[model samples]
Each structure stands twice: as structure tokens, then as C-alpha cells.
Target: MPWTVMPTFESYAQAREAFSWDLPDEFNPAVDFLRKHEDTSRTALRYETPDGGLETYSFDDLDDRSDRLAAALADFGVDAGDRVGVVVPQKPQNPITHLANWKLGAVSVPLTVLFGRDALQYRLADSEATAVVVDPDVRETVEEIRGECPALEHVIELGTTDAVSGEAHAFEDLLESYEPGIDVYDATPETPTAIMYTSGSTGPPKGVRHSHALWLGRAAAAYNYFDRGLEPGETTVWTPADWAWGAALGGTLFAAWHHGCTVVGWPRDGFDPEDAYDLMARHDVTKAFMPPTALRMLTAVDDPEAQYDLSLETFASAGEPLTSEVVDWVEETFADVAINEFYGQTELNLVVGNSSWYETRPGSMGKPLPGYEVRVLDPETREPLGRGEIGELAVTSDDRRVFFDEYWKLPEKTANKRTEDGWFLTGDLVERDDDGYLWFHSRTDDVILTSGYRVGPMEVEEAILHHSDAEQAGVVGVPDETRGEAIKAYVQPATDDYDPDTLREEIRDLVRDRLAEYEYPQHVAFVDELPTTTTGKIQRRSLRERE
Candidate 1:
């Protein structure tokens, strides 16, 4: 067997019918990967630094390093079910730490490096993490908040740098001192593997605990949605999303490695279109996934096709709704490449997406993936809505492929997301057509009501982005005396020379011509940049608060 898509079927319907999820009594993702593939020489991870440095690791190497790190963690009194926070970048050490945790049956808590001191402290304190593995660059910040976190006991530092005082252990020293032989823990499918925090755009971040079976659930997204059935050592997958986010960790790293494909990891120093384009060409990347913000930046690049010899065959976008303009730009730029858009959350990995096997309708989020079912329901009535009616998106709770165990410790919050009839409310508003394609409307809170008319900001934002001069747009409702709320848009200009007054009027006219009278933005303000999360999702709540 050459690591191709297993259980191959003739058609998508056949594949969906044949798809079976059977997990062993004791399963670990890392162990399962090594067991399935006998050839240890295959490349598992391929990493590149910001300044052109490259490194490749084999499965054998990862197994050995993860074993050593697991032994060291055991020596440090880290037992099964203990929370170990990881705050490293998208390097070899990040995945290594995660694998080590899985081997020990401990929960791995991923902390983004971009977090400030307060956000970092909140997570550490909230999770009650007993140990943390961090890079040398973030050591000082960790130390500053160390005293505030009462549960954190040990600080394990990676990279070669000056060690801090107070019980800090060197990562390399542990690997050298400990024997690299330990039995893999008998972790069942329900065992906690990782706790990923939400971006907290609305409020404080909530930790979402996922079971060990999450890696197995990701197969549909990888094999079906991504259409990556590459042979061993043939496919190169790349994503700029940090390892902390579920998109990069589960979508790119684990999904690619599960299929024995090489995954590319790079540092997240702001988005640079030229550098990103060059990396894909240099590495011959065949599949890539990016956030909508990054895609917008790449579209803004002058002569993108002439800049680099892009080897990308398939590209996908997530994190937010992909604007119609960006979708058209991708088709025009990558003439032959297939562009698919996916939808998922921190709790659910890939619930809905357009696959290469299906026809992609721009601005539509596609249908439910195999093993998952989605529906649109009225918020107040909790009744399923008909086709073409906008309502809150909900997933059937019985679908094991796309459900989380719980919201870490918040029982009330977890209970609130589920309906009495066993459907998980996604908090996102969307509509399904008669053809079964899902279309994004807005977040329940992001929807605007002006003069007794309901509006979705995405519709107005899409119309504004249709203009040649507008790079990015954020639409929200501001206060009004006559109308309950008025539409206001924050526009980021594509060029610096354009007059703000003229551009604003142009955007307003475009919306008026395209949409209804109440949907047009009454106030337009030009800004250099909009607020975003670490994962590049626009902060609409923050935008509304500024008004």
C-alpha cells in the first residue's frame, strides 16, 4: 500500500456510505502513525525559519525525541490527565511536545505566542496548567506572570538561551538525561488529548477539550475535503496558521502526517505576500490553506502571478467568510488551481466545506461533510428553518465526527450550546438553499437591524470589496436616533493616493446600486487597519465598541 486514500470508492456518495470510523481500545495518534507506516525514513515534518533556514525530520527521529521528552515529563511528576501548557512557535518542538503529551495521556494546552502578558496569565490560571513548555524568547514574559499562576509548578524552556532562576529546566538536558524508552499510555478514544482556546472575540477565551479521537475525525477533512490522496513523499502541505490554532495543528500538521505527507511550518511574523509566495514555489507546495485576511493581502500584491512560480494546486480559506472579490481574484490568479472554502470552529474541526470532488459555488460554504450533518434553526423557536431562510447554524449532536466533549470546565456554557433535542448551536447565522449549499449571513450578534429591516454585514462588506480601491472592509451598525441602528463601514484603502471622500462615496454608491436602500452604509470611515485576532479573524465586536 502506498499511503493513498484508503477505502477508495467510485463516487462521493459511495465514499460517504463506505466511510467507517473504528478506533482501537487504546489509541494514540502518534503511535497509530508509526504503526501504520513501516518505513521510518519517510519525512514527517519540514520546517523553515523566517530568514531562509530549513530543517526536516523523519518519523524515526520524532519517535525517538518524543519518547525522550515523555520520559523526562514522567520524571518531572507529570502524570496522566495533567494539563501541560505549550507556548512554542510552529517549529519541530511544538509537535514534539504535543506527541510527548499524547504518549503520556496528559492534556496539551496550546498557548499562542502572540498573546500579551495578561492574556497569557488568564489562560494559565484558567486551565490550572501544572507545567508549561515555552521557547527562550517568551521566557521573560512567562516569568513575569509566573507568580500569578498558582497551579503552574515547573517551567520547561526550549532553545539555547540564558536560563532563568527558580526551577527552570533546559529542554535539551532532559532529553539527554532521560532514557528514551517508555511504554505508550493506554489512552482510550475518550481520553483528553488537547484543550484549544477560542479567539475570545466576544469575551474571555474558553478552553475546548477534545478527545484523542479528534485525529481520526479529521480524516474526512483531509481525504475528502482537501482531496489530498498523495503518495508518500509526494505531497507538500503548507499553512501559515500558528500551531496553536486548530486549523494548523489538526488541519495541516496532524492531517498531513496521518497520510504520510510532508508538512511545512514557518514563523508567524506578520503576513508578507512576497515571502509567502516564494516559500510555496521554493518548497513545491501542492496544497495550502490560508485565512481570509492573508488571502486578501496576497490579492493586493501587484502582479502576483509574475512574482513567483507558484506550485500550489489546491488552496482553501477559512477563519472567516471568503469575500466574493477574493474568490474571483484566486480564480483569475491561479488559473488551473482549485480553490475550496471550508467552515469549522475550535470545538468542531471541519463540519462544512467544498471539496475538489464537488463544484464550488463562490460565497457558499458548501454542504455537510461525510459523517456530519448541519441544519439551520430559528433562534427563538428552536425549530428547523426552511430552505433560503437565514437562521442559526446547528449540528446534530449524534454526529460523532463533529462534536466536542465539553467546554473544559464550564458546564453552563456547554449546556447552553446544545438544544433540548440534541443539536449544537454554532452561534453563526446562515441559510441553506434548495440545492443544500450553505451560505453565511453573519454572527447572531453581528447582524444589523436598521429601521425595522434586518441586514447581514457580510452582504454590505462584499459589495464594498467589489470596488477596485477597497482592500478590506468591516461593516457594523452604529447608533441612530430615527432608525434603531444605522449601517457604518470601516474601509481600508487599496492605495494611499486615493481621496477618502471620493472612495467613500464610490463605496456607498456601489452598495446602493447592488443592495436594497436600507442595506447601504450611511457612514463610511477610512482607516489604515482593522482589529484582528491572532488567527486573522476580524473583531467586529471591537469595531462596534469603537462606535
Candidate 2:
């Protein structure tokens, strides 16, 4: 296999100075699998079925199936530049559909199976997706929205649930009917490849579209973030996060496949700590793209190492900032693993993060990744800010490969994400230190102004989580006459046994002492559960709506 963006530098400084994105004029994500069409024996995916059975797919297998599926899609009238939605979990069909879409020069729109009718309809209609590949379980959901989505012509069933062939085309039969080994499309770096939707935490979900170069842009950062392709062993990768999320798809699965490594997938309803531990041990997973929330949930397992034998080497985390407590626990839990915490968004990802080349300062987003010039900019002036100055984090286009193409036809929304001089605004508040480390404060909108002080919800939530009883915390700014906006915390206690009134006081005191007195939440409401995305990130906007 021809490896892309191999790391040769010994230190982060050398890498920062030496690295540059070198991509070919013609690029497609499928071609990143350099060893494809040759090796059928080498495993590409290892998926665990619902009945506790394991299914494996090799590179040759994927190539053939994807070729057939691509031919079938062509017969369905899916052409170049068309959008094909893949709305399934971590199944083999998920990867197959994506590969087929790219091979035909069509754009793949990945939608999580966790979305409801309105959520699914909005994306399908917004993208005007012509065809979609869905598991039988969610075929009914898609069928229900067919009337609203006039552009959708074909619904292809991917899995078994006895869905009649009358409603949707049987994916397996279509694949069998088509012939394999069709010619792969030669696409330019600017060829539209994917349109990924944001989590819609703040507003309606917007489609962050990208070119084929997105893979090349993300490949280098993924290499560094995952410890230079997790060398020195038979690297088996896994992540509990949904495959639709950027972190898991781009960072974990595609990165692994590009490097000819094995990726394991287990489709489950929710994150079960016990089941997660068992799966990791059984598969001997050496690398993971674990979200911070998943790491927090795994902490509840008492002596996990004793109960399960794990061979994890690199545990990469993102989606949310890592708190000191979780970082400390990760260090103590995994003796040999490198905990690399990175930073990125749906629009621009893997731009800044930590790798194995340097010492990671706790709670700080590491220096800029290769080919990206991330900076702190004055929100209003659009001017670069000095080190340690809090401002909006922006990606100055040192290379467009590390950025999205557009907001998928939403010209006005796309315009708002960029400054006139051309810096892509992330709308996140952060600070870069003199040492070249970036620290996240909060979203520009999530920053709470209370009693003449600027308070970030993350710092407050981190302190609240420090309390032994705090299982989860979502902080927001609520309306207040006295203070411009009061800091209100929605807390999920660790257990049902704790006294709510007493624990609330303790939480308030913990933040008051750990941080400034002004940072503590004036209003603490204990709830059984907090609203979260499928990836386990707390939806602060949902909490805001509760006000």
C-alpha cells in the first residue's frame, strides 16, 4: 500500500515547519486505499452483528460490492454531482454506499440512523438527494417522508427486516444483478465528494459540503493524531461514536482504511460501558477515536482493566474539550496509551490537535495541524489576536484542502462563515498561548455575561463534573434582570442516592472555589437526564429552550 502523509519528523516544531499538504490534481477518497483491487484476503472491516456474530469484509470484497452497488446506482439514474444519502450505523453497507457514491462521482451525504422524521426529511430535502441506502429498520421512517421529499426517487434497503421489494429495491439483489469491475471515476480535487450536516445544536442543521480534497486535507492530521498510523503492531481501530460523525468517519475509519489497517464496528443502541469494555478486549483494539463523553461514561466501570484485557495504544478524543479530571483518569487507566485530544468542527476539522511528538498541556487544544493555519481573531475587527488573547478561532487558508467547499447551496449562510479577507470563522471562542497551544473558552454565543464578568459554560461544567455526584453537566446563560444573564446549570447526578439539595450546594461551592466566585452557577437544577446528540455531546441549545 502507498501510505499518504507519513510522519518523519521527531518533534512537533519540526513537523510544523516542514509539513505541507501535497495532493494530486486528481483525487477520490476510494483511491486512498492504494492496495485495493489486489488484496482480497487482507481484512478491511470487522463488524459485530446484533446476534453477537462477527462479519468481516476485505478490501477486495469492498471493491467488488461497491462496484456492483455503483452500477446499480447508475441504473437508478444517479449521475455525477448527484447526492446519495447513506443513513445507517456502522454496518458494511454504510462504507459500501459511500465508496459507490464516490466511485460514480456522486456526493455522499451521511445521515445518522438516530435522527427522527423531521431531522431526516430536512437533510434529504435540503440536499435534494436522488437516492438513499438505508437499513430495513429505518426504511419505514424514510418511506414516511417520501411525500415531502419530491426529489427522492429510489429507496434501497441495505439490511434484513423483511421489507417488501415493492416499497424499496432489495440492495442485495441489485448488487447481484449488476456486474463488478466498472471503471472508477477520475475526479479532480475540486470534485464534490460529500455534504455533511452539522449537529444543529445552535440552529437548523446546515450542510457543510466539501470536495474530494477534504480526504487529503484530513489524512495528514489523522496520521499525526492517531500516532503516525499507529505503527508497531497489527493496528485494529474502533470507536463507539456513530460513523456519520466526522470524528469517527474521517478520523478513525477512513484514516485506518487508507493506511490498510483493520477497523471494527459494533452497532448498538446506546453506549454500554460493560459491552464497550468487552468488545475492545475481544478485538484487541490498538487505536480509538473516543469522544470525551464516551471516556467519561467508561469511568463508571470499577477496575475495568481487571475485568477486561485491553491492548489499546492510542486513544484519540475530540467533539468536546477534555477536562483535567478526565485527562487524569485516562492517564491512570491506560498505562501504555497515548491520549491525544484534538480540536475541529463539521465545517473545518482536524485543523488543530495534539499528537505523540510533544508533551500535551492539560485542557489545551494542541498546535496547528499540517497544512492548516488556525488563528485567534478579533470577532469584530477580523484581525489576528495576540497569544493568550481570547477571540474567535478562525482558520486562515494556508491550504484550502483543510477547509470545506461551501454550505451546500446556502450562499448566504456560507458567506457568513467567512470574513471579507477570507478567514473561515469557527464561531468558537478560544485562545492560543505563547507556547503554541490553543485553549477553548466557549462558543461565541454560549459565553455567559453575568454581573459584568464573561463566563464560559465549559469551564463551569468542568468544575461541576469535578463533584463526585455530577455524572453530566450542561451549562447555559439564562435571562436575568440583575445580572445580564445568569449562569444556570442542568446537572445529571452520578447516582440516584444523592440528596439533591445538598449536592446542589456542593456543586455551587466547588465551582466557586475552583474558579472565580462569579463563575459558579446561581441556579442548579438536577435532572435525570440531559439532552444530547447521538455522539454523546450535551446539546446546550436544548437546555436553553427549557428556559
TM-score on alpha carbons, each prediction = 0.80, 0.81
- The lDDT leader among the candidates is 2
- The local lDDT score (0 to 100) that residue 205 gets in candidate 1 is 60
> What TM-score does structure 1 among the candidates reach?
0.80
lDDT value, candidate 2, whole model: 0.81
Among all candidates shown, the one with the greatest TM-score: 2
| CA deviation > 4 Å runs, candidate 1 | 1-5, 161-166, 199-203, 302-306, 397-402, 446-547
Q: List the residue pairs that clash in candidate 2.
A: none
* Cα deviation of 273, candidate 2, in Å: 1.3
Local accuracy by lDDT, each model: 0.78, 0.81
User: Model 1, range 1-547, lDDT digits (tens) per residue?
Assistant: 2222445667667655665555556678768665467577888878887577888889888889889999999888898999999999888889889989988988999877766565578789899998999877678878989999999998999843355445688887777777767889888768889888763224456789889878766754766666745446788888887787777788778888777788888886667878888888888888888776677777767776677887777887676677677778888877677778888877877788887767789999988876677889998998999999999999863345346888888898889878898888888899999989999987776766554344667767877898999988888888764444689999989889898888888888787655544568999998899888999767888999897
Candidate 2: regions farther than 4 A off = 1-5, 34-40, 160-165, 199-203, 231-233, 446-547
Decoy 2 TM-score against native: 0.81
